[model samples]
Target: MATEERNHVSNGEGDREEQEDEKMEQFFALLRSFREARDKRKHELRLRDHEEDINKKMKKSKASKLGNDERSSWVPRFEWEDFTSEFEFPRPLVVFPTPYNKKEDQKNQEDDDGLDLNLTLSSASL
Candidate 1:
Protein backbone atom coordinates (compact mmCIF):
# COMPACT_ATOMS: atom_id res chain seq x y z
CA MET A 1 0.00 0.00 0.00
CA ALA A 2 2.84 2.47 0.74
CA THR A 3 4.47 1.84 -2.62
CA GLU A 4 1.13 2.32 -4.44
CA GLU A 5 0.58 5.74 -2.73
CA ARG A 6 4.02 7.02 -3.90
CA ASN A 7 3.28 6.03 -7.49
CA HIS A 8 -0.15 7.79 -7.48
CA VAL A 9 1.41 11.08 -6.12
CA SER A 10 4.07 11.07 -8.83
CA ASN A 11 1.40 10.53 -11.55
CA GLY A 12 -0.64 13.48 -10.24
CA GLU A 13 2.40 15.81 -10.44
CA GLY A 14 3.09 14.81 -14.03
CA ASP A 15 -0.53 15.47 -15.05
CA ARG A 16 -0.39 18.98 -13.45
CA GLU A 17 2.77 19.86 -15.43
CA GLU A 18 1.14 18.76 -18.70
CA GLN A 19 -1.96 20.92 -17.98
CA GLU A 20 0.23 24.02 -17.34
CA ASP A 21 2.07 23.51 -20.64
CA GLU A 22 -1.20 23.21 -22.56
CA LYS A 23 -2.53 26.49 -21.03
CA MET A 24 0.67 28.32 -22.00
CA GLU A 25 0.39 27.08 -25.58
CA GLN A 26 -3.24 28.24 -25.83
CA PHE A 27 -2.29 31.75 -24.52
CA PHE A 28 0.48 32.13 -27.09
CA ALA A 29 -1.87 31.09 -29.93
CA LEU A 30 -4.49 33.66 -28.85
CA LEU A 31 -1.83 36.44 -28.73
CA ARG A 32 -0.59 35.53 -32.23
CA SER A 33 -4.13 35.63 -33.66
CA PHE A 34 -4.83 39.06 -32.10
CA ARG A 35 -1.65 40.54 -33.61
CA GLU A 36 -2.48 39.16 -37.07
CA ALA A 37 -6.01 40.68 -36.93
CA ARG A 38 -4.64 44.08 -35.95
CA ASP A 39 -2.18 44.04 -38.84
CA LYS A 40 -4.93 43.05 -41.31
CA ARG A 41 -7.10 45.94 -40.14
CA LYS A 42 -4.25 48.41 -40.64
CA HIS A 43 -3.56 47.12 -44.15
CA GLU A 44 -7.23 47.46 -45.11
CA LEU A 45 -7.35 51.08 -43.90
CA ARG A 46 -4.30 51.96 -45.99
CA LEU A 47 -5.75 50.28 -49.07
CA ARG A 48 -9.01 52.24 -48.72
CA ASP A 49 -7.14 55.55 -48.36
CA HIS A 50 -5.07 54.81 -51.46
CA GLU A 51 -8.18 53.99 -53.49
CA GLU A 52 -9.81 57.28 -52.41
CA ASP A 53 -6.75 59.26 -53.43
CA ILE A 54 -6.71 57.64 -56.87
CA ASN A 55 -10.41 58.41 -57.31
CA LYS A 56 -9.88 62.09 -56.46
CA LYS A 57 -7.03 62.39 -58.96
CA MET A 58 -9.12 60.76 -61.67
CA LYS A 59 -12.01 63.20 -61.03
CA LYS A 60 -9.70 66.22 -61.26
CA SER A 61 -8.19 64.95 -64.50
CA LYS A 62 -11.64 64.44 -66.04
CA ALA A 63 -12.76 67.95 -65.08
CA SER A 64 -9.67 69.51 -66.61
CA LYS A 65 -10.09 67.48 -69.79
CA LEU A 66 -13.73 68.62 -70.11
CA GLY A 67 -12.65 72.28 -69.69
CA ASN A 68 -9.97 71.87 -72.37
CA ASP A 69 -12.47 70.27 -74.79
CA GLU A 70 -14.84 73.22 -74.38
CA ARG A 71 -12.02 75.72 -74.92
CA SER A 72 -10.88 73.92 -78.11
CA SER A 73 -14.29 74.41 -79.77
CA TRP A 74 -14.14 78.23 -79.51
CA VAL A 75 -14.20 80.27 -82.80
CA PRO A 76 -12.53 83.67 -83.45
CA ARG A 77 -14.82 86.64 -82.58
CA PHE A 78 -13.82 88.65 -85.72
CA GLU A 79 -14.25 87.88 -89.43
CA TRP A 80 -11.01 86.96 -91.27
CA GLU A 81 -11.89 89.18 -94.29
CA ASP A 82 -12.58 92.25 -92.07
CA PHE A 83 -9.28 91.78 -90.19
CA THR A 84 -7.25 91.55 -93.44
CA SER A 85 -9.01 94.59 -94.98
CA GLU A 86 -8.30 96.83 -91.94
CA PHE A 87 -4.65 95.82 -91.49
CA GLU A 88 -2.16 98.46 -92.84
CA PHE A 89 1.33 97.58 -94.08
CA PRO A 90 3.18 97.61 -90.70
CA ARG A 91 5.01 101.05 -91.03
CA PRO A 92 7.78 100.79 -93.74
CA LEU A 93 10.37 98.31 -92.50
CA VAL A 94 12.69 100.34 -90.24
CA VAL A 95 16.26 99.04 -90.70
CA PHE A 96 18.62 99.33 -87.69
CA PRO A 97 22.30 100.09 -88.52
CA THR A 98 24.70 97.11 -88.26
CA PRO A 99 27.54 96.81 -85.72
CA TYR A 100 30.51 99.23 -86.09
CA ASN A 101 33.24 98.21 -88.65
CA LYS A 102 36.87 98.27 -87.38
CA LYS A 103 38.08 100.05 -90.62
CA GLU A 104 35.41 102.79 -90.39
CA ASP A 105 36.16 103.33 -86.66
CA GLN A 106 39.92 103.78 -87.35
CA LYS A 107 39.20 106.19 -90.26
CA ASN A 108 36.90 108.30 -88.06
CA GLN A 109 39.52 108.47 -85.30
CA GLU A 110 42.22 109.64 -87.81
CA ASP A 111 39.89 112.31 -89.22
CA ASP A 112 39.21 113.62 -85.70
CA ASP A 113 42.98 113.85 -84.96
CA GLY A 114 43.65 115.66 -88.28
CA LEU A 115 40.90 118.22 -87.53
CA ASP A 116 42.33 118.85 -84.05
CA LEU A 117 45.88 119.39 -85.49
CA ASN A 118 44.60 121.81 -88.17
CA LEU A 119 42.69 123.80 -85.54
CA THR A 120 45.83 124.05 -83.34
CA LEU A 121 48.04 125.31 -86.29
CA SER A 122 45.48 127.94 -87.31
CA SER A 123 45.12 129.17 -83.74
CA ALA A 124 48.94 129.51 -83.36
CA SER A 125 49.23 131.57 -86.58
CA LEU A 126 46.61 134.00 -85.22
Candidate 2:
Protein backbone atom coordinates (compact mmCIF):
# COMPACT_ATOMS: atom_id res chain seq x y z
CA MET A 1 0.00 0.00 0.00
CA ALA A 2 2.76 2.48 0.81
CA THR A 3 4.51 1.84 -2.51
CA GLU A 4 1.26 2.39 -4.44
CA GLU A 5 0.61 5.69 -2.70
CA ARG A 6 4.18 6.84 -3.48
CA ASN A 7 3.72 5.95 -7.18
CA HIS A 8 0.40 7.84 -7.39
CA VAL A 9 1.94 10.99 -5.84
CA SER A 10 4.88 10.84 -8.25
CA ASN A 11 2.52 10.60 -11.21
CA GLY A 12 0.50 13.61 -10.02
CA GLU A 13 3.69 15.69 -9.56
CA GLY A 14 4.83 14.77 -13.08
CA ASP A 15 1.50 15.85 -14.53
CA ARG A 16 1.62 19.17 -12.67
CA GLU A 17 5.18 19.87 -13.97
CA GLU A 18 4.01 19.22 -17.57
CA GLN A 19 1.05 21.62 -17.17
CA GLU A 20 3.33 24.32 -15.72
CA ASP A 21 5.80 23.92 -18.62
CA GLU A 22 2.97 24.24 -21.17
CA LYS A 23 1.66 27.44 -19.46
CA MET A 24 5.16 28.94 -19.41
CA GLU A 25 5.60 28.18 -23.15
CA GLN A 26 2.26 29.84 -23.97
CA PHE A 27 3.18 32.95 -21.96
CA PHE A 28 6.54 33.27 -23.71
CA ALA A 29 4.83 32.92 -27.12
CA LEU A 30 2.31 35.61 -26.27
CA LEU A 31 5.09 37.95 -25.10
CA ARG A 32 7.09 37.40 -28.31
CA SER A 33 4.07 38.10 -30.52
CA PHE A 34 3.31 41.33 -28.63
CA ARG A 35 6.88 42.56 -29.02
CA GLU A 36 6.86 41.83 -32.75
CA ALA A 37 3.61 43.73 -33.22
CA ARG A 38 4.94 46.71 -31.29
CA ASP A 39 8.13 46.78 -33.36
CA LYS A 40 6.15 46.60 -36.64
CA ARG A 41 3.95 49.51 -35.60
CA LYS A 42 7.00 51.59 -34.70
CA HIS A 43 8.61 50.86 -38.05
CA GLU A 44 5.44 51.87 -39.94
CA LEU A 45 5.15 55.11 -38.02
CA ARG A 46 8.77 56.00 -38.76
CA LEU A 47 8.25 55.37 -42.45
CA ARG A 48 5.16 57.54 -42.50
CA ASP A 49 7.05 60.38 -40.81
CA HIS A 50 9.87 60.19 -43.33
CA GLU A 51 7.41 60.34 -46.24
CA GLU A 52 5.69 63.36 -44.75
CA ASP A 53 9.02 65.13 -44.35
CA ILE A 54 9.87 64.45 -47.98
CA ASN A 55 6.52 65.77 -49.16
CA LYS A 56 6.99 68.96 -47.16
CA LYS A 57 10.44 69.52 -48.63
CA MET A 58 9.12 69.02 -52.14
CA LYS A 59 6.34 71.51 -51.62
CA LYS A 60 8.76 74.08 -50.23
CA SER A 61 11.14 73.61 -53.14
CA LYS A 62 8.36 73.98 -55.69
CA ALA A 63 7.12 77.13 -54.01
CA SER A 64 10.62 78.61 -54.01
CA LYS A 65 11.06 77.85 -57.72
CA LEU A 66 7.72 79.45 -58.54
CA GLY A 67 8.68 82.54 -56.60
CA ASN A 68 11.98 82.78 -58.49
CA ASP A 69 10.18 82.43 -61.82
CA GLU A 70 7.73 85.14 -60.90
CA ARG A 71 10.55 87.45 -59.87
CA SER A 72 12.38 86.83 -63.16
CA SER A 73 9.27 87.54 -65.22
CA TRP A 74 8.74 90.99 -63.74
CA VAL A 75 9.62 93.87 -66.16
CA PRO A 76 10.28 97.42 -64.97
CA ARG A 77 8.55 100.18 -66.92
CA PHE A 78 10.68 102.98 -68.40
CA GLU A 79 9.73 106.25 -70.19
CA TRP A 80 10.32 106.52 -73.95
CA GLU A 81 12.42 109.68 -73.43
CA ASP A 82 14.57 107.83 -70.88
CA PHE A 83 15.17 105.05 -73.38
CA THR A 84 16.02 107.49 -76.22
CA SER A 85 18.34 109.53 -73.99
CA GLU A 86 20.30 106.41 -73.03
CA PHE A 87 20.89 105.38 -76.71
CA GLU A 88 24.46 105.76 -78.08
CA PHE A 89 24.65 106.64 -81.79
CA PRO A 90 27.37 105.34 -84.21
CA ARG A 91 27.39 101.94 -82.62
CA PRO A 92 28.05 99.02 -84.99
CA LEU A 93 24.71 98.09 -86.48
CA VAL A 94 24.27 94.58 -87.95
CA VAL A 95 22.18 94.77 -91.15
CA PHE A 96 20.98 91.75 -93.10
CA PRO A 97 20.63 92.53 -96.83
CA THR A 98 17.64 90.90 -98.49
CA PRO A 99 17.94 89.27 -101.91
CA TYR A 100 17.80 92.04 -104.58
CA ASN A 101 14.69 92.23 -106.76
CA LYS A 102 14.69 94.29 -110.01
CA LYS A 103 11.16 95.65 -109.45
CA GLU A 104 12.06 96.88 -105.94
CA ASP A 105 15.25 98.51 -107.30
CA GLN A 106 13.32 100.41 -110.00
CA LYS A 107 10.71 101.59 -107.47
CA ASN A 108 13.51 102.82 -105.10
CA GLN A 109 15.17 104.78 -107.99
CA GLU A 110 11.90 106.47 -108.90
CA ASP A 111 11.30 107.38 -105.20
CA ASP A 112 14.79 108.96 -104.96
CA ASP A 113 14.23 111.06 -108.18
CA GLY A 114 10.86 112.25 -106.81
CA LEU A 115 12.58 113.29 -103.55
CA ASP A 116 15.27 115.20 -105.50
CA LEU A 117 12.63 117.11 -107.55
CA ASN A 118 10.75 117.98 -104.29
CA LEU A 119 14.00 119.26 -102.74
CA THR A 120 14.71 121.52 -105.82
CA LEU A 121 11.15 122.94 -105.77
CA SER A 122 11.36 123.61 -101.99
CA SER A 123 14.72 125.42 -102.37
CA ALA A 124 13.34 127.59 -105.24
CA SER A 125 10.29 128.55 -103.09
CA LEU A 126 12.66 129.44 -100.19
Candidate 3:
Protein backbone atom coordinates (compact mmCIF):
# COMPACT_ATOMS: atom_id res chain seq x y z
CA MET A 1 0.00 0.00 0.00
CA ALA A 2 2.86 2.35 0.67
CA THR A 3 4.48 1.68 -2.70
CA GLU A 4 1.18 2.20 -4.52
CA GLU A 5 0.62 5.56 -2.85
CA ARG A 6 4.16 6.71 -3.82
CA ASN A 7 3.51 5.70 -7.46
CA HIS A 8 0.20 7.67 -7.47
CA VAL A 9 1.90 10.80 -6.11
CA SER A 10 4.63 10.62 -8.81
CA ASN A 11 1.95 10.23 -11.52
CA GLY A 12 0.11 13.27 -10.24
CA GLU A 13 3.31 15.32 -10.32
CA GLY A 14 3.96 14.26 -13.91
CA ASP A 15 0.44 15.27 -14.93
CA ARG A 16 0.85 18.69 -13.30
CA GLU A 17 4.11 19.27 -15.21
CA GLU A 18 2.41 18.41 -18.53
CA GLN A 19 -0.44 20.81 -17.79
CA GLU A 20 2.01 23.60 -16.98
CA ASP A 21 3.90 23.06 -20.28
CA GLU A 22 0.65 23.23 -22.26
CA LYS A 23 -0.35 26.44 -20.54
CA MET A 24 3.01 27.99 -21.35
CA GLU A 25 2.64 27.04 -25.02
CA GLN A 26 -0.83 28.59 -25.13
CA PHE A 27 0.46 31.80 -23.58
CA PHE A 28 3.26 32.07 -26.16
CA ALA A 29 0.73 31.58 -29.00
CA LEU A 30 -1.46 34.35 -27.64
CA LEU A 31 1.52 36.71 -27.39
CA ARG A 32 2.53 36.00 -31.02
CA SER A 33 -1.01 36.66 -32.25
CA PHE A 34 -1.16 39.95 -30.40
CA ARG A 35 2.14 41.11 -31.89
CA GLU A 36 0.98 40.20 -35.42
CA ALA A 37 -2.23 42.17 -34.97
CA ARG A 38 -0.39 45.20 -33.70
CA ASP A 39 2.05 45.14 -36.63
CA LYS A 40 -0.82 44.85 -39.12
CA ARG A 41 -2.57 47.84 -37.60
CA LYS A 42 0.60 49.92 -37.86
CA HIS A 43 1.05 48.94 -41.53
CA GLU A 44 -2.51 49.95 -42.34
CA LEU A 45 -2.11 53.28 -40.64
CA ARG A 46 1.06 54.02 -42.60
CA LEU A 47 -0.63 53.19 -45.89
CA ARG A 48 -3.52 55.49 -45.04
CA ASP A 49 -1.14 58.31 -44.22
CA HIS A 50 0.73 57.88 -47.51
CA GLU A 51 -2.55 57.88 -49.43
CA GLU A 52 -3.61 61.11 -47.77
CA ASP A 53 -0.30 62.75 -48.64
CA ILE A 54 -0.69 61.73 -52.28
CA ASN A 55 -4.21 63.15 -52.37
CA LYS A 56 -3.06 66.50 -51.00
CA LYS A 57 -0.25 66.72 -53.56
CA MET A 58 -2.63 65.84 -56.39
CA LYS A 59 -5.05 68.56 -55.31
CA LYS A 60 -2.28 71.16 -55.17
CA SER A 61 -0.99 70.17 -58.62
CA LYS A 62 -4.51 70.33 -60.08
CA ALA A 63 -5.08 73.79 -58.61
CA SER A 64 -1.76 75.07 -59.99
CA LYS A 65 -2.56 73.69 -63.45
CA LEU A 66 -5.94 75.39 -63.42
CA GLY A 67 -4.35 78.69 -62.45
CA ASN A 68 -1.78 78.40 -65.25
CA ASP A 69 -4.53 77.63 -67.78
CA GLU A 70 -6.52 80.67 -66.67
CA ARG A 71 -3.46 82.90 -67.01
CA SER A 72 -2.72 81.53 -70.49
CA SER A 73 -6.20 82.49 -71.71
CA TRP A 74 -6.23 85.86 -69.93
CA VAL A 75 -6.49 88.99 -72.13
CA PRO A 76 -5.81 92.45 -70.69
CA ARG A 77 -8.10 95.24 -72.01
CA PHE A 78 -6.52 97.89 -69.79
CA GLU A 79 -3.84 100.33 -70.96
CA TRP A 80 -0.18 100.34 -69.83
CA GLU A 81 -0.77 103.56 -67.90
CA ASP A 82 -3.58 101.92 -65.93
CA PHE A 83 -1.35 98.91 -65.10
CA THR A 84 1.64 101.09 -64.11
CA SER A 85 -0.53 103.32 -61.93
CA GLU A 86 -1.85 100.32 -60.05
CA PHE A 87 1.46 98.52 -59.57
CA GLU A 88 3.55 101.63 -58.84
CA PHE A 89 6.74 100.24 -60.34
CA PRO A 90 8.58 99.58 -63.59
CA ARG A 91 6.67 96.49 -64.61
CA PRO A 92 8.10 94.14 -67.23
CA LEU A 93 6.07 94.50 -70.43
CA VAL A 94 5.13 91.79 -72.91
CA VAL A 95 4.45 93.07 -76.42
CA PHE A 96 2.23 91.03 -78.72
CA PRO A 97 2.57 92.09 -82.38
CA THR A 98 -0.77 92.66 -84.06
CA PRO A 99 -1.68 90.76 -87.25
CA TYR A 100 -0.22 92.02 -90.51
CA ASN A 101 -2.38 94.96 -91.60
CA LYS A 102 -1.18 98.10 -93.51
CA LYS A 103 -3.04 100.63 -91.31
CA GLU A 104 -2.01 98.85 -88.09
CA ASP A 105 1.63 98.71 -89.14
CA GLN A 106 1.62 102.46 -90.03
CA LYS A 107 -0.01 103.34 -86.70
CA ASN A 108 2.56 101.25 -84.79
CA GLN A 109 5.43 102.92 -86.69
CA GLU A 110 4.10 106.37 -85.84
CA ASP A 111 3.74 105.40 -82.17
CA ASP A 112 7.33 104.11 -82.08
CA ASP A 113 8.64 107.34 -83.64
CA GLY A 114 6.67 109.44 -81.17
CA LEU A 115 8.01 107.37 -78.24
CA ASP A 116 11.59 107.79 -79.52
CA LEU A 117 11.15 111.58 -79.89
CA ASN A 118 9.74 111.80 -76.36
CA LEU A 119 12.72 109.91 -74.93
CA THR A 120 15.23 112.03 -76.83
CA LEU A 121 13.58 115.29 -75.72
CA SER A 122 13.40 114.14 -72.11
CA SER A 123 17.08 113.19 -72.07
CA ALA A 124 18.07 116.50 -73.61
CA SER A 125 16.04 118.45 -71.05
CA LEU A 126 17.61 116.55 -68.18
Highest lDDT scorer: 2
Q: lDDT per residue, candidate 3, 68-114, as tens digits?
A: 86666656588678757755458768889767999987997975665
lDDT of 2 by residue, 92-126 (tens): 88899999999999998976665554435565366
Query: By how many angstroms RMSD does model 1 differ from the true structure?
Result: 14.9
RMSD values, in order shown: 14.9, 18.5, 20.0
Model 1 collision count: 0
Worst 10 residues of 1 by lDDT: 115-124
Tell me the whole-model lDDT of each prediction, alpha carbons only. 0.87, 0.89, 0.86
lDDT of 1 by residue, 1-126 (tens): 999999999999999999999999999999999999999999999999999999999999998988786667767687678867865676887899989999998998975665454445565366
**Regions of model 2 farther than 4 Å from truth:** 69-126
Arrange candidates by lDDT, highest first: which order? 2, 1, 3
State how far residue 61 of model 1 sits from its true place (Å): 1.3
lDDT (Cα, 0-100) at 84 in candidate 3: 70
